[model samples]
Target: MLKRIISGLVGFILLLTIVIKGGMALSISVLLLSLLGLYEFNSAVSKNGIKYVSIISYTFPFLLFLMFNIRGLGLNIQIILFIYILSILSILVLKKDLLLNDISVTLFSLLYIPFLLFHITLLDGNKLIWLVFITAFGTDTFAYFTGILFGKRKLCPELSPKKTIEGSIGGILGSLLLSLLFLKIFNIEHYVQLGILSIICSIMAQIGDLAASKIKRISNIKDYGNIMPGHGGVLDRFDSILFTAPIVYYYITYLL
Candidate 1:
C-alpha cells in the first residue's frame, strides 16, 4: 500500500511536469511512453505464442509519432492505411505460418497503444488537456474507495473481480463532479457538454481498464510489467488515459 501511494505521487508529479511543459517536452514524453507501452504489450502478446515481425512492431509506432508531429507531411490517413496494408501483405508473403494472427495482433497494438495515445499531442495548447488526466485518475480513485466500502456485486468477475457495480457508478459520479469543477475553474459555460463528456470518458476509462485486465488474464500474467513497483507498467497505469484522451480530443475539437 505504501509503495503504491509513493509511486502514484511520483508518477503524478512527472505527468504534471510534462503536461505543463507542453511542446517538445510533451511530444518527447509521449514518444517515450508509447515506446515503453508498446514494449510491454508486445512482450505480453509474445507469451501467448503470437509472433510479430520485430521491424514492424518497433518501427511503426515511431512512424506514427513522426506523422503526427511533423505537420503538412502529406502522410494522411490514406497514406497511413496504405502503409499498414502493405506491411500486413508483406507479413503474409514472408511469414506463412500464423500470418493472420500475427498481422492482427501487431496492427491492434499499433492502433491501441501509440495511435490512440497520440491524441494527447493533438490536444496540445488546450486547457482541457488536464481534463484527460482528471477523468482517468478521478475514476480510478473513486472506484477504488467505493468498491472497498460498498462493493458487494462484482462488476465483471471474468475480467476483473475486484471491480464492483457500485464502484463504477461512483467513478462516473466522481468524474462528473471533477468535470464540473474544472469547468467552473476555467470559467467555461458549457456545463452540459462537460457533463456529457465526463460520463463518456468515465465509461471509456473503465472499459479501458477492463480491456487491459483482460489482456493480462489471457496472457496469464499478473501485471504488464514491474516498472512501477506497485503499479504494473506504463500500460497498466495509463490504460484509462489511452481511451479517454482520444475521446476528449474529438469532443473538444468538434463539439466544444
Candidate 2:
C-alpha cells in the first residue's frame, strides 16, 4: 500500500512537472505517450488477428504528429479521419479473402481506439482535460481500497469480479469531493461547471476501467504489462483517461 502510494505520488509529480511546463516538453510528452498508447492498441488488435497491424499502428503517430504541426483552420483532424476511412475502404476492397463484416470491424476498431484517445491531447490545458483525469484517478483510488475493505456484494461477476456496487458509489462520491477540492485549491471560480464535469469524468473513468477489464478478458491475460507494480501497465494506468478525455474534451469545447 505504501509502495503504491509512493509510486503514484512520484509519477504524479513527474507528470505535473511536464504538464505545468506547457510547451515543447509537454507536447512531446503527450505525443510520445499517445504513440505508446497507439502501440498498445495495435498490439491488442494484432492479438485479435488483424493483418497489417504494424502499418496501421505506425500511421497513427505519423498522422498525429503531422496534424499537430499543421497550422490553419484545424481541419487536419477531419482530414486524417477521412483518410483513415478511405484507407479502410481501400483495404477492404483489396482483400478479396476477407469478409466484409470482418474488414469493417477491423477498420472501425482501428479508428476508434487510438483516434479517440489521441484527440484528448488536442484539448491540452482546458479544465476538461484536468477534470477527467483527476476525477478518474480519484475514483479508481477510492474504489480499490473501499471495495477491498468494505465491499460485500459483487458488481460484475465476469469482467471485474471484485468490484462492488457500494464501492462504485463510493468512488463516484469520492470523485465528486475531490473535484470540489481541486476547484477550491486552484481557485478556478467555476464550481457548478466543475461539479457536472466531475460527474461525467467519474462515469467515464469507470467505463474506461471496465473497458480495459473487458480487453483483458478477451485476451485472457491478467494485467496489461505490470510496469507500475500495483497499477499494472501504461494502458491500465491511463484507461480511465482514455474514456474520460474525449467526453471532457467534447463537453468543454461544444456543450460546457
Candidate 3:
C-alpha cells in the first residue's frame, strides 16, 4: 500500500511537471513513454518464445514517425501499414525459424499496441491529454482500493480475481471526481460535455485493464514486468491509457 501511494504520487508529480511545461519536455516524455510501452507490449507477446525481435525493434520509430506525420494525404498512415507489412516479410527472411502464426501474432500485436497508442498524444489541448491520464490511472487506483475494501462480485475470476463490480463502480465514480476536479481547476469550457467524456473514459479505462489482463491470462504470465515495483510493467501501468487516450482524443476532436 505504501509503495503504491509513493509511486502514484511520484508519477503524478512527474506528469504534472511535463504538462505544466509543454513543448519539448512534454513531447519527449510522451515519446519515451510510447517507446517503453512498445517494449512492454513486445515482452507480453514474446512470452511464446517467438522470434519477434525485428518487429519489436521497428515499433518505436514507426509509431513516432506516424505521430509526427499524421497529415499529408494520409501517406503517414499508409506508410505505417507498409512498415508492418515489411515487418511481416522481414520475419520470413530474418527469422527463418519463426512460423507463419508467430509472424501473424507479432504483426497484430504491433498494430494494436504502439501503432494505436501513438495517436492519443497527438490530440490538441493539454487538459484533454491530462484527462486521458487521469481517467486511465485514476480509475485503476480507485478500482484497486475499492476492490480491497468493498469488492464482492468478481468481475472476471479467470483473468483477474480481485476485480469486482463494486470496484468498477468506484472506479467510475472516482474518475468522475477527478474529471470534475480538473475541469474546475483548469476552468475549461463545456463542463457537462467534459463530465460525460470522463464517464466514457472511466469505462474505457476499466476495459483497457481487463483487456490487458486477458492478454496476460492468455500468455500465462504474472506481471508484464517488474518495471514499476508494485505497478507491474509499463504495459500494466499504461494499459488504461492505451485504450482511454485514443477514445478521449477521438471524442475531443470529433464529438466535443
Candidate 4:
C-alpha cells in the first residue's frame, strides 16, 4: 500500500510537470512512454515464445513521430500506413517461423499504444489535453476510496474482482468533479458537453483497465511488469488514459 501511494504520487507529479511544460516536452514524454509501452506489451504477449516483427514494430513509432513533426518528410498518412502494412507483411512472408498470430498482435500493439496515445499531442489547448488525465486519474482516485468505504457488489469479477458498482459511480462522480473544475477555471459554459464527456470517459477508463486485465489473463501473467512497483507497467498505469485520450480528442475536435 505504501509503495502504491508513493509511486502514484511520484508519477502524478512527473506527469503534471510535463503537462505544464507542454509543446516539445509533452510530445517527447508521451513518445517515450509509447515506446516503453510497446516494449512492455511485446514482452507480455511473447511469453509463449511468439516471434514478432520487432525491428519493424520499433522503427514505425520513431518514423511516425518524425513524419508528424519533420515538415520535410510530410508524407501522406495513407502512404505511411501503406508502407507499414507492406513492411510487416513482407517480414511475415519471408520468415517461416513467424505466423499471422504474431503479425496480428504486432498490429494491435501499434494501434493500442502509440496510435491512440498520439492524440494527446493533437489536442489544441492545455486544458483540453489535461482533460484526458484529469478524467482518468481523478476517476481512479475517487473510485479507490469509494470502493473501500461503500463497495458491496463486484463490478467485473472475472476481469477485476476488486472493482464494485459503488466504486464505478464514484469514479464517474470523480471525473465530473475534475471536469467541472476545469470548466470553472476556464470560464466555459458548455456544461452539458463536458458532463457527458466526463461520464463517458469514466466508463471507458474502467473498460480500458479491464481490457488490459483481459490480455494479462490470456497470457497467464499476474501483472504486465514490475516496473512500477505497485502499478505493473506503462500499459497498466496508462491503460485508462489510452482509452480516454481518443475520446477527449474527438470530443474536442468535432463536438465542441
CA lDDT of each candidate? 0.89, 0.73, 0.76, 0.86
Best by lDDT: 1
Stretch of 10 with least lDDT, candidate 2? 49-58
- Candidate 4 per-residue lDDT, tens place, 92-187, comes to 999888899999888888888888887787773557788899899988889999999999999999988899999999999999998999989888
RMSD of model 3, in Å?
A: 2.6
Off by over 4 Å in 1: none
Best by TM-score: 1
Runs in model 3 lying further than 4 Å from the true structure? 55-75, 93-95
Model 1, CA-based lDDT: 0.89
lDDT of 2 at 230: 72
> Model 4 compared with the native: what TM-score?
0.95
C-alpha RMSD of each candidate structure in angstroms: 1.3, 2.5, 2.6, 1.4
Work out how many backbone clashes candidate 2 has: 0
Over 4 Å off in model 2, which ranges? 1-3, 72-75, 95-106
lDDT tens string, model 3, 155-219? 98888898999999999999999999988898888889888988898998888888889988877
**How many residue pairs clash in all the candidates, one count each?**
0, 0, 0, 0
Q: What is the C-alpha local distance difference test score of candidate 3?
A: 0.76
Off by over 4 Å in 4: none
Global fold similarity of model 3 (TM-score): 0.88
